[model samples]
Target: MATRRFPTREELRVWRDFIETGELVRSAMAARLQKDGLSPGDYTVLLALSEAPGERLRSSELATAVGWERSRLSHHLGRMEKRGLIRREECLTDNRGAEAVLAPAGRAIFQQVNRPHLRDIREIFVDALTPAQLEAAGEIMAALREHLTRE
Candidate 1:
């Protein structure tokens, strides 16, 4: 029988802290977003669209930008469309492709919600970390993302 090597105590501690902190932060942010009638996923999609050129992006590009599957993005986009938050139109560049655009109402809602969202983020995350720690955290997250995205 082969024996498996266990993680070191420090490695376990790091994992635990990472997971716990992530859960807490996500929950906190979700609660605040819910109060504004938006879910995290909704905000993510809106933010991505708002940042795109002319506030529009190809459906596939939007999915990749928001790290969601096409089906999931499609479902969410349907809901958003019903809420007048976004519109889906045929892509001008590709006859078969669709595009997502942020609607005026969506832009207004995002503008209204941004201040509170930023304050909450600052209170729950940025304010809690030193500048150096914040920089390090950003680097660590980027590195992890790069590593995980490798084929």
Candidate 2:
């Protein structure tokens, strides 16, 4: 039986290379986060909250920022809350909606988790990217994320 023929190269050099690179970065970051008693998602939430306008964010917005569905965000938040890392408050503007707020414990963990995470990122990813490449990478990711979400 004959197999389908393929071209030597298509138009996916960036995509293909990135997938390989992304997994490398993810693995390194995951291991680093694990040493700090956190997962990548947990670090992301803490990072997002720390950068959020008020150290708090509406659940819906958090879900979007985290690239998670509402239910997924809720489940993660529940775990974070149980671990004393975050608190959920009923949104006054929308009785049914809630906000995820970082607590003091969460803030400290952010500092602890962040220092090592940043160092790991610097070593594993940032060092691997040139200034131009770094900017382009962010631009590409933001553009693709928006483009895909819109579709």
Candidate 3:
């Protein structure tokens, strides 16, 4: 069979639905997070640090964990540092490198917001889907991730 050069009407419709639904979900989550004084980026960074050994990670590792470029992460880290959410310290093992550490304030805020975040997720996503649909969604995500890695 020849490869199609363009999506069929049905494929286009599904693509639009997927993109729009993703944006809606992202918007809802961002709104909820903002109400608790954290952006999605902030939450992502905090969560990574909170899970790392010693509640810290090297700056490059942090950028990778958050899937952000070094420059973007550095700027955001600066803002977060000013807000007392995180601190950068010279890496003990590498004089030229630094580590992102979850400050006490960051940890406290993360703890405060985590439960409500979960509740929002449950209400906005989980409750909208059947258990089987949820499982299928997970599988779909895995497939997409695998495909992206091959590219």
Q: Which of the numbered candidates is closest to the native, going by highest lDDT? A: 3
Candidate 2: tens digits of C-alpha lDDT, residues 83-124 = 999999999899998999998999998898787777887998
lDDT of 3 by residue, 1-151 (tens): 8999999999999999999999999999999999989999999999999999999999999999889999999999999999999999999899989999999999999999998999999999999999999999999999999999989
> Candidate 3 — which residues are off by over 4 angstroms?
none
Error of 3 at 38 (Å): 0.4
Candidate closest to the true structure, highest TM-score: 3
lDDT of 2: 0.89
lDDT of 3 at 31: 97
Which of the two, 1 or 3, has more TM-score?
A: 3
Clashing pairs in model 1, backbone N/Cα/C closer than 3 A: none
TM-scores for every candidate against the unseen true structure? 0.84, 0.75, 0.93
Candidate 2 versus the native: TM-score?
0.75
Q: Residue 141 CA error for candidate 1 (Å)? A: 2.2
Error of 3 at 19 (Å): 0.9
